[model samples]
Target: MDSKTPYKANLIKQQKVCERNFHKLMKLLPDLENNDNLVLSFYLAGWEGQARFQVLERAPYTTVLHVNLDAAWGQWLKLPEFRIRIYRDVRMAEIISVNKDRHFKAIYPYPNEKMLMPDEKEQLNQLFSEWLNFCLTHGLNN
Candidate 1:
């Protein structure tokens, strides 16, 4: 057996977790067929992944809320290191970034009192739910 086999296998597992969580987050966004202001961009590569949900405004850099989730793994690690960044401005004037080492119990837009795994459904759901609400209340128009 190749020595790299186990590492590759672990990476596959982490990639699936990232993909599944990415889809869960995507479901919470308003449908793309009906809304042009909101866009989702996702990319995954073996043990690493990145997903972004962006709310655009009338003018570029005028207004935007960008939520990004990134995951990666070190050798021999089963779970990837996950990080979440919430950016409230087009120019990224206001930003919050959290890593997996932190406990995640509450949702974002609120104090994340605890840390959470990147793939945890409940936290992902709450995060996206609040994001959608924020977009709507702030005039996403779609």
Candidate 2:
């Protein structure tokens, strides 16, 4: 066995973990059939700021969710980034006058609100684990 091989295997394992997390989230959401008005954004990062994947979706009466595997936290913590944005009053005449860009900006700011907050780093790790299970079982993606 080669020394470098072990490092390569570890990298692959991490990649798999990220992929599984992404798929698990997607699978939890309801499938879109017709209309096309919803939008989704996903950012994939590894280590510091290495981006690996980006996905977007658009459909009516749909929910958009972003799932990210935050590798920066390391083993001491498991940090998963989650975001949900809902658009409303699109079909109304008066609401149609609203600025599209500005509305989107207001809903999705640079920083998002957290659904799960823990008192400590260790607690945060536990929260992430619980979140993964809850999102998977409760179908919170949509």
Candidate 3:
């Protein structure tokens, strides 16, 4: 792995959780292949309130595919938030840059006081399904 990879450490920390979520989502989407066409990466960021999940294309910096999840919103929605907001923001911005630029700033919305509820697992799976479908449809992976 590249030493300068931005989210290497974060990805390592959340590998199991992210993989579990990804596998569940993949099972739901029969059309998506787990091989070359699709790639998945996950990371955790320490925003003021709590840690958030960041998902991005597992390609080099030249590829312009990425996403960022808002921990605050995830907490609010009781879902495992992972970069949906960032994806939407980038679509709105129409910036054609690769994933090299950190286009977002951290902010504290609320402290993470609640425990990891059981339902969050299902919610995370659902969210990942939506994201995977989006990626497959847009040809972002292949």
Candidate 4:
């Protein structure tokens, strides 16, 4: 085995990330529970962009949200899209999918099906965290 952080799940970090994500999501969409979708325009000097958050499913204590970043990201035409699952009771949110790829494992075999990294889930949640931080810090409904 490679000498690394042993393959243990980082529950503490994941939980923290989830909680922060939930908080930022609520900040971006204060009417999330009452409304089905939220649209925000981001304007900074010469650049202007938009972000859309739509609730795909809603339950008593759970909600699935689809976030679309509507902007030109260099050469990529599709940009980035995220589907997040929110747990209202726990005040947590996690990335269910990114750009439509849903499967994530805490650890994966070296020669697995998709060449996924060992810590795919952790990486995904971290990416979500960074994205949310960027949106909250630089853009939004404020």
Candidate 5:
């Protein structure tokens, strides 16, 4: 097998994930043009949480959105937060920033100063997918 085979495979998988999450985000962003901010609440199945979405930048073919966990409970919880750049024409959404840091590499050297994992990029995208899935499945627009 070629050395690049694994990387190519991962890239393909990540693209699928991003594309799927884009559709999910679109579902959650209904009536998007009228409002800049939207919040969704989830309380069913003994789970309680909220997700806040804001449009940071809008363009003809691309949009940047900031998403975060909105905790009505308290401030002690560490929320999962990220900024997504959606390519409308391509139908893809990707995480540009996460955990308050704006820069992330596709791969990182282990035991580095920041301690980011090697697959940080893929992890962040996967995380965005999970969050989108959870919110769409459990959330109610508010």
Candidate 6:
């Protein structure tokens, strides 16, 4: 087998994961379809090494949720990741990341939050659910 075979397979796996999660988000928040600012790209861009999903914030004046993949699949270290940022009237209020070292950090505007690590499906679901509610409460989805 060629060395690139594994790498290619890893990439494909990562893409599938991202795609599944993207669909999950869509299922969770049907309102996402109404937001023109929302961009769902399950696959990596031509120049991007990571696949990501982004959501724009309403109250924060221009925030965005940037969900990124830390590394290719099959890598010894690396996992799904994300972050929140601000842009021109397009910011994401919450910040989150799953690092290559398996450290997961999520900062939210709300209290009583927990730190989530990669491969933790329950935690990940909670995180997304909270974010969806956060956006709804902040009037982003309206």
Which candidate should be chosen as best, given TM-score against the real structure? 4
Model 2 over residues 21-122: C-alpha lDDT tens digits?
434434443342232232332223423321111223444643343334434444677444533322322211001111121122112221236322112222
The TM-scores of all predictions, comma-separated, are 0.25, 0.28, 0.24, 0.87, 0.85, 0.27
Each candidate's lDDT (Cα)? 0.37, 0.32, 0.34, 0.83, 0.82, 0.40
Q: Give the better candidate number (2 or 4) by lDDT.
A: 4
| Candidate 6 regions with alpha-carbon error over 4 angstroms | 1-9, 35-54, 57-63, 66-142
- Superposition error at 58 for model 2 (Å): 7.9
User: CA RMSD for every model?
Assistant: 16.1, 17.3, 15.5, 2.3, 3.2, 16.4
Residue-wise C-alpha lDDT for candidate 4, range 69-95, written one tens digit per residue = 876442466666899999999999999
CA error at residue 21 for candidate 5, angstroms: 1.1
- The TM-score of predicted model 4 comes to 0.87
| Candidate 1 lDDT, 1-142, residue by residue in tens | 3434321123344334434434433455546324534433332343443344454433432333345543354335442222333222311222222333444432232223443333344444345445434434332222
Q: What number of clashing residue pairs does each candidate have, in the order they appear?
A: 6, 3, 2, 0, 0, 9
Winning candidate number (lDDT) = 4
lDDT at 38 for candidate 4? 85
Cα lDDT tens digits for candidate 3, 1-142: 3335322123332334445444444443334322323333323243222322223343322222234433444655653334322122121111222123223212212223443322333334345556555444432221
Clashes of 6: 9
How many clashes does the backbone of model 4 have? 0
Model 5 ranges with Cα > 4 A deviation: 1-9, 45-47, 72-76
Error of 2 at 41 (Å): 20
Worst 10 residues of 3 by lDDT: 89-98
lDDT (Cα, tens digit) per residue for candidate 5, span 55-101: 99999998899888876453676777889998999999999998778
